[model samples]
Target chain A: MAPSIVVRDVLDREAVRRSVDTALADFLAAKARTATSQPQLGYLSGLLQDFMAGGKRIRPLLCATGWYAVGGGEDPRSVFQVAACLEMFHAFALIHDDVMDNSDTRRGRPTVHRTLAEHSAGRRGEEELERFAHSAAVLLGDLALTWSDELLHEAGLTPVQLGAVLPLLNEMRTELMVGQFLDLDATGGLTDDIEATLNVNRYKTAKYTIERPLHIGAAIAGAGAEAMAAFTAFALPLGEAFQLRDDLLGIYGDPGTTGKSRLDDLRAGKNTTLTALALRGADAAQTARLRSSLGNPLLDERGAADVREIFEATGARATVERMIDERHRQALAALEDSPFPFAPDALAALEEIAHLATVRNS
Target chain B: MAPSIVVRDVLDREAVRRSVDTALADFLAAKARTATSQPQLGYLSGLLQDFMAGGKRIRPLLCATGWYAVGGGEDPRSVFQVAACLEMFHAFALIHDDVMDNSDTRRGRPTVHRTLAEHSAGRRGEEELERFAHSAAVLLGDLALTWSDELLHEAGLTPVQLGAVLPLLNEMRTELMVGQFLDLDATGGLTDDIEATLNVNRYKTAKYTIERPLHIGAAIAGAGAEAMAAFTAFALPLGEAFQLRDDLLGIYGDPGTTGKSRLDDLRAGKNTTLTALALRGADAAQTARLRSSLGNPLLDERGAADVREIFEATGARATVERMIDERHRQALAALEDSPFPFAPDALAALEEIAHLATVRNS
Candidate 1:
């Protein structure tokens, strides 16, 4: 195995971390300038910035770290380019996801549509306020997606490496699209069975959030299939745990910590496993009330409280927690069978991170 | 110049033309193979076919033609790939446009969101039918867009070409988004002067419909600035003519030929140059009545006729027609100024086609 893993304290990875941030910031700065040269460019760029401003730097760091992991000898700048690509795609998903969920806020601010709608409403024009914002946001999502591809292709990756990774990115997007659809479907009527929902969760969240980043980084590093397979196996289950844990947080966590509305799923009527299980096991009366409350935005403090009561009464939260725990265990088990003889330290460190992510305090 | 340009009919333009029937069939075949692989893939894929299946293939053909126009060597397959990219982008626009317009029908079929909503109403026990369709269609649009970037990057474009063109594609989408904002601005209040309206028309319609296609083709052909400038000069006015003709047809042409309701703009209270002109010149009563009838889907035949009468009395229709003619002439004049020297026969033929585009048989 190549000697590229940069294992130390997460804090100590600052040099690599700074490189990742610089790469993305430079790209965004340049891209944003160009994007705003035309009229109303300010609005779109502002939305883009707000949608993508800061994160745990998890995906990009994984990209850079994975590149380093596989013994890539190149400048880490290129890895940051790849990382930027990953984040741009993530931004694309978030923008569209917000619209799909009729979500009002993101990252602790009003969402693009919500903001636009509010502004338009203040001006007393629905045409300017709602549809324009939604449509433009949709277009901006596409623009970000195109930029992700642009950054990847121009990231100074070798032709061979670029070629190898292009199809994966393509498949990644397709899979994410499918996963989002499955998620929406599962919400509506539970047309997909439990297996289907899990698969969707795995593909949409697990793979995109973790596996694809690692695979792409490994590609840049020229890692072999054995490494990729092991990495994917490890990442997928970990990713599932990540999302399932998020589902838990969405319900029970404090809003200030997660920076999302507590129990938003109840308001959105998202048919999460927690919700689905609650619906399945509830008595007819409970089920009817739950159905009516699925998207009752007017669900006031009492409404949110009453809904939480039903969730606890149904024991769905426990079911979700159990699922999360199982996935976490599976992810760690995959790492145990990992084939790499290199970087036991990094592997061990990753296992620790997975645990923290799944059993997140927030 | 390359030898392929004059090889055959407009349909025979190796860069641009294909049998519409054949391409649609191919799109369907490719689309079918996609959705069945995952849970929600089928749902989104079907929505794409709904929006994409019926266009005149003009944009795709232009994409192909643009590839050929710059003296590139003949390769039908490559042009098809390029053309496919344009159609995919257009499909993306249509899906979102449907939502923006609150449009119920497109190309003699139900629009994406409306169809989803209608399907929900049909399904007896389904909850949130409108939400289901909107979410489904948004995901579908994302997939088509995602597919477009994937297809283009893998289109065997060189690094330099990809660098130049992919960002162009991104910029174009961004500009279009900005244009959409301007469109909302103009339509919401109609306070913009006629000049502003014309500029809005140029950005929103001409650039999207014509100039971008020409640029896309030139970029593929590796056209230098001299070539690009010439191409843009040729396309801009031609594109304006195309859109102005559309505005005219929206009100005056046969519904059978246009495949939309006659004077549909009048019924919808569209804020085009025609309407802007009418509104500017109209008295209090006419303006008030015009506002009421716009976008009212339930407007009866009599109501539509009243609006049309107001349109004629205002002389906006004739004013709009004259503007269309002026743009057509400018387009031809620009062709004469093009730096490339093709055969007089070719020039004459193209000139004739431009005339055919603007002149009505009736």
Candidate 2:
């Protein structure tokens, strides 16, 4: 058997990203060409192409790494195609998410619904235009989802490979939707339940964003149980830390850097671990202040500042920082102790990813 | 080889509906049972179950007939499972469609979003509650879509059968979304583009609701190109006729029988073939009256009556009826001339279904 190590190509993040992007572009171009009867499809495909160009490619990178970590086959073409499928699926999730949050912009540009609304400007009354845009955006998201499945089907996996991958993909999708439902249900209401907040983080970010991608790649490589378990051990804590960092950035990061308003979570009253910690530690007066200001639609920067002050005063911010630090350490430790043999370079790559995930601002 | 004729069980529509329902019920029960940590999933599953109970099971019936029409294997179990998947997919489509249309009721009950909004009546302000319900409903729809895929995966089809069906399913979903986009774009305006309206009908209803379901089942039975082509020949006109009948029913059917407000399509300014014909034939004063009244949100019985009068005056209603009749005849003729060598019972079932589809009140 070939050495059970990811090749140099899979380990190179830039190379993987480029290949995945090429796969996506080719698939979408084919779709546009075939849809001659529906010019609207070409327009939507263009929007998707533009929307996709701005992503960090983190999932695709991780997927490729996971495949190599388990000593997948020599040719990486199918891996790249599968990675592109993941990216397309992510596009679907984000488009619907923007519509759900009524977010105005994403990646420093207008959201899909906002762009569509602008496209129809002057065609109808404001309310009708908004309705039309939202509906069209939803349809566009649905198309992306279907197209993602097409990408997977066309990826040319053997029956054995396809069988191994389908269940994991199904679980990941269902888990993401469940997490979304939980998050939507919990929004607009302040909660002091840190455990509940972390639960959401696990399903929405840890499993969906980190663990499953790794598991999928490993499965494609036909990794045994030991490697799969080791991935979970390393992935969960790292994934949580990743989201914890995101929670911090959502409040404290620069808009120019994060490509979103820092105030959105506060205004949406997102029951994040940070906010839950603050609520758990607050005194009566602080609790009252946090409750009133967090979910207020009119919350301004001054209000955000007051909320931040309370966060600091109650030690929630510091505690969350410590939590991130501990989880990051735990992830690195899991990687060190894992039974699955990894090449030296694969080990180093994973460590580098862990740092990037937990320590970044955006 | 077994004769290519569907057995008695496959011909029995009521039995098909029962088996499909059982499959759906069993699958949802497993979902609810496994989602122990998320009680919200249980609630959503219950809602889905209730929602599913009211469906006519037309897709499942067509799927079974299609399978037998191509002389599938003896056991009908896998076909039932696949039929259930189609029904589940239809649920996903309807739930999202309600959100897009902002419709209040479906099947004589509150729409999914409306039901969810009522469930949270006292929890948030009116606007926030609406937002929450819409978001949650979209998530629920997403879940249903995911679960439908799960159903297909779990169905005990050989890999070859799966390979045959996946492309057809993908095409059906993409076509449906494209049709939905066109329909949304055309709404809120009066159009005399009869061909465009028919094109939308071909994709949205004819192909998605009729042709694809039949093709998927036939593919599962390992049907060849000629048989597939025969199904299409029989399905397209029947499907168009079905939608044409629906357009008339939407405007003229009784609320008691249709279980929906007839004013909904008019209020939404749906650009159906019936409406297109009306616009094509109306005089200036009649055109102005139709345009003003059709899309008026507050349009009541009196306004609907005026619109109906204009429809009659322009002979739009008569033209639509004649169109349905002509297409229905074409569908029957195609079935008669097909060379696929269907069993006598299977042919009778298709003929019965064609009659039911075009001559229904609901």
Candidate 3:
């Protein structure tokens, strides 16, 4: 189950680009032709245009890595269809998530709901904004959802592969929805149970974001049980670290560079590692003030700064950073312990991912 | 490509039931072991426990028929997976639709959301009630979605057969979403265009409800292109009639029989056949009243009564009945044009379905 060191430099990016690009192009074309013989869903195929723009193809690369993990020969093109499924699935989540979180931007552009809300606002009154956002987001999510299945079908996997992937992919989708519910439930309810909150991230974010795609790719590549077990052990801790780092970025990273607000987590009062730390570290007086001011739907920038000051004073930032490093160490340790096929180049690239996720400015 | 009458009858009933039971039971058991496993979903599985209770099993039956139409053999067991997929998908649609429409009851039991919302009301606040309903509906939809893929995976068809089903199924899901959009878009938009309004139902409801399932069954059955084309021709009209008949029932049928209020459509000012007729036939005052009251979200029994009177006066019910008859005839005529191996028994059974859809009584 040794993975080979195939591409060392980014100059080999064309291979990865073609993998995703070919899928996207063929997907759009095939979708365009569907329902034509029936003449029902006129031009509905075009809903995909804006929804899929500018993905970095990271998921596809991860999928390729999963395939590589199974002692499978590299057929870069063969992984494209699977890669497309992962990417499309990611987009599907983003569409629904934007509505749930009321996010205004994605990547560098307005989120789907926000864009649609703005369009609705232009033609209508103020109250129409949220309603338009909800309605539009729902359909857009459906569009992304259907597109995922279509891409998966076109992946050219065998019957055995289909059996392996479809159920897992579908199960991933279900877990994602439940994970989102678990998260929303936790947000609405609470305990001192930090583990419960983290479980939400594991199901809601990590498994699909990391594990399932890896599993599907590996499964398709015919990874045996032992190989899968090793991969799982390596992926779980690494995945946890990935999400924890993402939460940190949400609160502390430069807004201009991230295309997201640094103060958003503060304004939203996300109960993340830093928030949990601040809560635990706060004195009675500080706790009351923090509790009273947090989760303000009407948060202003000044109010946001007030919250940030509390995070610093409470040692929350340092606590979260320490936790992040510990998890990262744990991730590397897991890889070392597991019998993963680590080509030197892959090992380096995987390390680079850890740095990019945890240490990069954006 | 010729379809047999005996085949359609058998597929329509016994085989369809077998598929639903086998696929659902086996799927639920397997899915429960996944990491995303839900103990509550087992309890919630009761929500679907009686799903097969009252359903005519028509869609599942149709899937088998479509498989046969596409050159599939009479190995009914082989078509089981596809049929399970059809039924699970329909169940998913139904559960979500009840939420969207705010239906209080389905199959004489409280709708899933209503059941949850009501249970939460006294124990929790209004917010909890809403969240419970929304979250439960989302989960139920997810369960149905997963079960569908599970069934498709086991459907015993070749990858090619599964591949064909995927695109069509996705298109149907897309159309259903688009139909939902079109329905919402028409909420306060132009309702004067009866044909346009009907297109939403045709695209959103009819195609998926009857046509696609039939096509899938025929496709899985290995019906050739000519048989498929014939199926498309017959199914489109028949499917349209099926919905049109249901719409009529919503306005004029007995609540005791339909398990739904006859006045509900009128109260909601639904843009169905009767409403369209009232628009076409009623005077200016009636039209203005209808426009103002549609989707008012407050119209009561008396108000609903007035709308019903208008429909009767305009003869909307009778016109729809005439259209239904014509549609049924067209569907039957279509079978004559195909080389479908629909043996005499199979043809008779399909014709019987045409009768069932259009007939006033059982």
Give the winner by lDDT. Answer: 2
In model 1, what lDDT does residue A310 have?
81
Candidate 2 on A1-362: residue-level lDDT in tens?
12332457787878887788888999899889877898878888998998898888888888888988988788877787888999999999999999998888888889999999999999888999999988888888888888988899988888888888898899899889889888988898889999999999999999999898888888788878999899899999999999999999888989898888978888888899999999999999999999999988789999999999998999999999999999999999999999999878889989988999998877
lDDT of 3 by residue, A1-362 (tens): 01332432222345656657667766766666765543424444454556677666666766776776565454544566777877877776777666656677766678887776665665544644466456556566666666777777766676667667666677677777767766655453323355765777777766767777677777887777776776666566667767777777787677776767765555555566566667778899878767766655567777767777887898877776787788777767766676766666656555655555556555
The true-versus-predicted C-alpha distance at residue A262 of model 1, in Å, is: 1.8
RMSD of every candidate to native, in Å, equals 4.0, 2.8, 4.4
Per-model fnat list: 0.70, 0.89, 0.36
lDDT of 1 by residue, A168-205 (tens): 77778888887887777666553214566567778788
Tens digits of lDDT, candidate 3, B143-207? 67656766776667776666666667776777777777666555443266778767877876678
Q: Largest DockQ belongs to which candidate? A: 2
Each prediction's whole-model lDDT (CA): 0.69, 0.89, 0.66
Regions of model 2 farther than 4 Å from truth: A1-6, B1-6
Query: Which lDDT tens digits does candidate 2 get at residues B77-193?
Result: 888889999999999999999999999989888999999999988988999999999988888888888889889998899989999999899989989999999999988777999
* Comparison by lDDT, 1 against 2, better one: 2
